[model samples]
Target: MKLFNRFPAIIHHDDSTTAPSLDASLPARKWETILFSTVLIWTFLGLCFPMYDTDFWWHLKTGQSILAGNGIPGLDLYTFTDADKPWIDLHWGFQVLVAILYAIGGVPLVTLVKAGVVTAAVAIGWRACGNELPAWKKSLVWIFPIICIAGRGNERPEMLSQLFLAMWLWIAWRSEKQPDWMWWLPVLQIIWVNCHALFVLGLIVGFSYAVDAVIRTRWGGRFGLEPRTDGPPLGAVFVVAVLVALACLINPYFEEGALFPLTLYRKFSVEKEFYRQNIGEFRPPIDFVMQFGLSNLFVISELIVWLVTAASFVWLLVKKGRWSPYRLILFAGYSHLAWQASRNTNIFALVSAVIACQNFAAAEVIRSVSVAGSTAGDRPHQTGKRVKLAQGMTGLFVILTGLVVSGVWNQIGEKNKPFGLGEAPNWFIHDAAKFAGRDGFPMRAFVAHIGQAEVYVYHNGPLRKVFMDARLEVCTQQTFELYNGILAAMAAGDPIWQNLFREGEPPVVILDSRSSRPAINGMLQNPTWRLVFADKTGAVFLHIDTATRLSLPPVDPSPLMYPDGEPKEKSRGK
Candidate 1:
């Protein structure tokens, strides 16, 4: 109150009709309660998809390393190729979190935590959609956004970022009514910067609010509007934004961590061609849509929600006769982010849904509903019937959401992501991992599959080193190129592949059979390498010299492992 009194010109005035209070603590209507409950259940089930994210293993391992007093790693210790490479691990906080969760309950606990984080984020956004909108309308707008975000809902630190983002957005929205909520921004920023590289979003959200305050203050009087007194003072908001930005420097790396995203973006932009071609998340949504067609429900949901949000902006502009600068900036900022990377589509989905729902709430015309009289001009009976109909529709939508979660969204694009908990057994080359983790096995291996390499290193690292893993940021572009070259040569059955292998000096090679099928075939024909283990997921090869020195007999290389053929486990066959 004192802050607002000091700078009355900067407060925003709400011009909309008197509607239901936006307080979340207020008791929800019966239908709203039912709808929100069902939506959360649906969100939990949807995000509980099988853990196919291979990057998870490495992240968990890194977390364990941090917990073990090794501290947040400043050097690459997992891979032989990039040994001692400079690494600024911004995700140290998130890594420690997941590590602790895993220590408590292993993969099942991590899965539950992942589901809970995402469900909670969605719930926060749902609350921000405003209480004035009908329950059915809110749920309807929410369905597609939930579906869209579920595509990236695997176990990753980005999920934490999403939850934090939701919290920041809610704080920003409510700070007008509760000015002290703005102070939480800087505190959250300190946690966010150390957790994920996307922490800059907190600053962006604050900046949007501050700019909105400045604009409305300087120009509203000229446009024949009286000074508003709803929001916090402009100077206070600006101070908060600056404080939030400065909080980014509270990380372990301080200045470097504060500016790490820019450094990362510079590297990624330079190598965008490679990452875009190789990484599915980095690829445009259109690329997947074109390749997979409309069968991909996730892609379709993304498109629908995106288009509807765009229409919502137009609708609000026409109905209100003025745009909310805060919302416009959020819409544009997230729109550009989603357009650039498919990984960001989930965050964009949350923003778009909140904005669309809020717009509808603001644009809706208020009407009276008397307990003993008619609503608008309708008879009491008619109102009762409409209420029942809405209840039925909301119930039906909930059932359909369950069906989609259980059956439809199991797979996104070409990936086989089923709805469940725990890691997918087939995803990890477990047999090879077990064999490699043995007491006297070779310490260095050329890992052909990036995903398998992550798992392999988690199961066996420091004690063992890999040619490479999925730390694309730490690994040089030259290493990636050389790895690609080795894959190509091995696939072609060229003896030149042996020369490429010399660079890494790996005595053992491991690869996913499906991803590196041609290379497996080439290895079967090459006398220089001996197949020591083979399974459906991947195979392990020992150099002939290493096998001879160890007296390890080769597995039967007679039956060629075709891409379509499923081979039974083989170990040291006579």
Candidate 2:
């Protein structure tokens, strides 16, 4: 408040006004309320798709397997191609939780779980940014970093990591002098290790804090509060860090749990060159900046974070004449992670709040620079600051209102509102029911794209054993390569495609006639597969063996069914 008062003049009146007028003080409190509401509203935007995050399918199935009394998946079970391969189901706990939610209320429950986690994350983050002061700086730090993280906040186990990140930050920053409360750090790590591969983030935070505490104890009186306990603070900090690492091994995978994040990082980084092109989130922030223009919201958010980080460093340099090594490391480590892959932006977001909050809460009025006195002249400036705060609150209200209205008003108008998940807008849902027929399907097969796969699962379309669904990780590297190989071969009129199909032929195949034109063409060219059904959204190709058993009318196969017999320039399309 004093630092804010240094902005020329404001919030100081008569030098003895113990508490300022409600009008002068209410805006700060109201602005905090506004920020809390904004975080909730924005957190929900993550579930803007009815069947968001196709990966949820495998997670669901994995959860079911765990509930089925099978041990947490220690080996690959979903893919037919990977019988010998070991699979690391790192997020087994999260999978079971969401699966239970889904079983109870279906998609609505899943959506709620996602919104609930992200909302909790943002809420915890708000506190981590500091309850001691709710300045525009904290709001800026909270709002902009959230925008960066929300890009990948979907219905995935990673959402659990995000929540854990916020909690870790909160507990970590608060445990500086309150060493008695540090025992919870290991408990949190145990849950984190079972919940997501990002458990390493918790370890990193614990280590950073432990080291920072040791340095502070050495410096004495420089890093805020003294250890509340009689013993040195380093003992508590070291105990917490060591136990956090040890707690990670409690998962079913044991040592694998300890090394899970390293393996996952290796999984992504080994094929880093390929993922940068294929995975949108793996693309660097600079790539987004180049492709999406400066005015793009994502880019703008990135810029805000980078600017604030740079400003924080500059502020530290000016005040202390040298970089506080720990602060610089915290900012640089997360910022670099975020810069490298867009998905890790959540790390930067939650950590930014911690860094800002911890710094703000620790900072003392530099006795050399702070004005020790405020005169009667400061009275008029209070009104100006109050007005500015009011404007900030009003702006927050307007933004929140716009989002709520945009999301809710779409019921009868344009039904596909982006602000939140709405009912499935495509006609495929209604159409697929008619095609599946009253009689049960003997088995379930593969659907090429996620939207189509979602439609299949939603309507209970059958043939069994999908080649792969939204859960990309459920498939082995060999299987994924083979699946794409089949699609490419079918599209390119390669004879090897038929040979590939002969290797692992599904009784039924569902694909988009437009986007999967090449695949459809290849299927039709084969006498073994017959086009038994068609619709605007997609078509179903029944193998010759199953075509006789199914009662649906079989359409004659033709090359002319698709435009130029080529896949759309954009593989997945409207």
Best by lDDT: 1
What value of lDDT does candidate 1 attain over all alpha carbons?
0.76
lDDT of 2: 0.61
User: Relative to the unseen true structure, what is the C-alpha lDDT of residue 343 in candidate 1, on a scale of 0 to 100?
Assistant: 80
Task: Kindly list the per-residue Cα lDDT of model 2 for residues 428-520, writing each as its tens digit.
Answer: 423543454335453445666634554554444222345555444445455666777778876676757445446543535677655576787
Regions of candidate 1 where Cα sits further than 4 Å from its true position? 1-28, 221-228, 267-270, 368-386, 404-415, 500-505, 557-574
lDDT tens readout by residue for model 1, 224-291: 33244677787777777778878999988889889888865654356667877877777778777779
What TM-scores do the predictions have?
Answer: 0.89, 0.78
lDDT of model 2, residue 12: 27
Model 2: lowest-lDDT 10 consecutive positions: 1-10
